[model samples]
Target: MFDVSEVTVIAVDVFGTTVDWRSGVIDGVAAIAGHHETEFDCPALVDAWRERYLPAVGQINRGERAWANLDAVHREALDECLEVFGVAGKFGAEARERMVRAWYALPPWPDAAAGLAELRRDFVVVALSNGGFAQLTHVVKGAGLGFDAILSAENVGAYKPDRRAYVNAAKLLDAEPRTILMVAAHTWDIHGARDAGFRTTFVERPGEKGPDRPADAAETTDCDLSAVSFADLAGQLRGARKGVDAGH
Candidate 1:
């Protein structure tokens, strides 16, 4: 129901939307645990660590806690998870810091790299994430993600679904809210951007939260466009652009 021709930029959510955080965190934690001859439920530990993410950011967004970047939030959650899992003493400060940096080394989803390249042909592609500037830069470079620009909630001193994050991204891109497309795997993310007057595109990422946990079916109707992967999204957008061009 929306016009692709109107979209001047595509701002994507980087965490679960573009990169697979669960697998990356699990791999990183398990590697560290293994090296230390420690035993714990790796998946459970990762899940527990991630479960703290939103609340940690929300504390800042709600002004209950002083502003902190995603790296700080992840470290806090990691420390808590280590204690809860009874593996706190297994790693020293250096090893724990390395584990926190695991967020930077996450792999992009299967469709992310190529699909992003395709979409970049017609629109400015950038990252809009809660991760700090350094964190996002590492991920983009490590994964070789070709974003024209990278934006972070750190820039606004807040995390999403805060409206300022989206608004500031639009302002940075010099585009109106309606002229930008917010692409994400999380419905809450899309909902936030849509509420901020930006168009939304929901990309389904199965197992974003955990294995076998696909994106909610209800999310399909909540956005201007829905696709199973970034490839499908690129195809749809390219076709829409073709139609617009032919008419012109």
Candidate 2:
């Protein structure tokens, strides 16, 4: 278990952890298909596109590829997805651009905004994501999630599961790795953070991968905490704070 009293800041993962990217991508792809008068399996396209995300980012993390922002990677994946879905050349340049930009406007999960607001009262809350600064900022503002600050892997030119990404976030916040809590929905992200000596929290987000492939809620010994939602996380933190204060 994590000692919440030692934590000074909470670094949140943006994409699948805090926002509903699956819904946003599906909607965006569906709109593009509709506009072009084409029939496509939007859900399959979204899944395929998202499957490319980690490997593309991993190539850069491993120094096998040059540094490129998530937007560029998304566009490359979009091209491949379009071809696979038999919708290539159906969209004009502007339409394709719009489709890639859909990531910038993802809506937050139902409990996200309110839960973060509650947590922010006691701890500094910031975004520590692989997304570009501009894209993260757009999502925060569009969703009205009121983050204390946004720190992207773009700052370190690497992606999560990379040590530099976690270390950079701690350095930027002027805190020790142990004093920063890394909260994410994906176990791989939690594993990375824990390996970097940061406390980890896994927020359960069913259907994060897809409706057919819902994320498992199995409790892992690797994580310090596991919560069903942001609201539940906030409550647990509040209780932990009280325990610390009373002991003090």
Candidate 3:
């Protein structure tokens, strides 16, 4: 395992890593359908919504449009998605808006809340994600997911894989990037965080696919740590520390 105690703060990525976004979005779409006996394609809708995500962020990053949080971008994507699925006017304004707000009600993964609770005991735990501040706050509150602080791409004026996002997180927490371990489920996120000079840990949820080491692999692999779940991650990080740090 990597030396985790060297990290003063553990910044987490939300969405798929901390919460089950797919289930939440599927439920929202079903609610929107409203007993119409419609057989909707949840996977298709989820994929399509995600497909538009980066383009929306790129628009803001390129200065073509002012920066908007992930919540607003999700709304825009939701509207486009509903229209594409032939359900444009099916939902009323209030109902449609609630569906958009579902992002705030994301449920924590089964092990996420408990693992975070444990990990928080030994480290300064925070959310470093692409989620908007309001959205992250709402979701964390709704799920009773405790965090010491929250940072997001919205604050950085850019999205993940952008150096600004990672740097902004470390800066706000007054910690060096190398001393911050970014725990995420996505390899790309881990790669980006590492490129930005932060240590990275990969938490592999069930059904979550990531890197597979090849035979005779080099020691210079990207992720600093990897685990099957947050509980396992807690164990790994805890084991990496030889002595207790007072600040944590």
Candidate 4:
């Protein structure tokens, strides 16, 4: 319960926080595999694909590998997963491309679009993610979520969980870190923003990693606030106003 009243801009992590990426990956893989009339363990494939995300991004974040946007990283992961799953030959180049593009149209979480709209009524809500600009633009638009700005770490050459990414995105908004509230489902992300001098809120996404894979649902952390969902976060932000220049 830090002073949410002072916050004017919200930097949101889009992938798992705003969109159900797990389902998207599963559905995307299933669709392609079915088209080939090939039975595959789509969910397992999705889990494997997602598990590679951290390492892929971590490589760039640590400068161990050359910088590549999320799309390129995802393509790399997809190729590896297909090979490991023994289905690499089943998916040709065109099919692989479509599977990767499917990421751009992930369905928003039930609370996402409306909740973000509510928050926007009182504060600037921006999508700040490790995704590339074009990828984020397509994802946000496809999900029908309205963001005041879409800031990508690719533009800054630094990814999230890296302090530089948060700092650089803050500059683009012409905002001081103190005036911005970083909203994310991942504690690592919150830590990054905190290190960059911003207040943070944890928005819970219990199913983000799917049913069997437990989410990062710590009841409390070092974050300024914790919310059950974006709608809950919006309500908390409104309550913090306390009638000063009250929300409409």
lDDT of 2 by residue, 198-234 (tens): 9989999886888798684637537898888878888
| TM-score against native, each model | 0.95, 0.96, 0.86, 0.95
- Clashes per candidate, residues 3 or more apart or on different chains: 0, 0, 0, 0
Instruction: List candidate 3 stretches off by more than 4 Å.
Output: 35-39, 208-221, 243-248
lDDT of 3 by residue, 1-248 (tens): 55565688888888878887767776776776655555566567766887798788878877899888887898889889878987776666776678778778877889888999888988899988888888888989988888898887868788987788898888898889999998887766788899999998877754421123221111333788777677898887776574445435
- In model 2, the Cα lDDT at residue 174 comes to 93
Q: lDDT per residue, candidate 1, 1-248, as tens digits?
A: 57888998999999998999889888988898899899999999888888899889888999999998888898889999999988898999998998898888999998889989988988899999999999999999888799999999978897889888899888888899999999998877888999999999988887788864555553454889988887888889889988988989
Q: List the residue pairs that clash in candidate 2.
A: none
lDDT of 4 by residue, 117-215 (tens): 989998999999988899899999889999999999876998888889988988888889999999999988998899999999999999998888789
Error of 3 at 219 (Å): 13
Candidate 1: C-alpha lDDT? 0.88
lDDT of 2 at 96: 85
lDDT of each: 0.88, 0.89, 0.78, 0.88
Which pairs of residues collide in candidate 4?
A: none
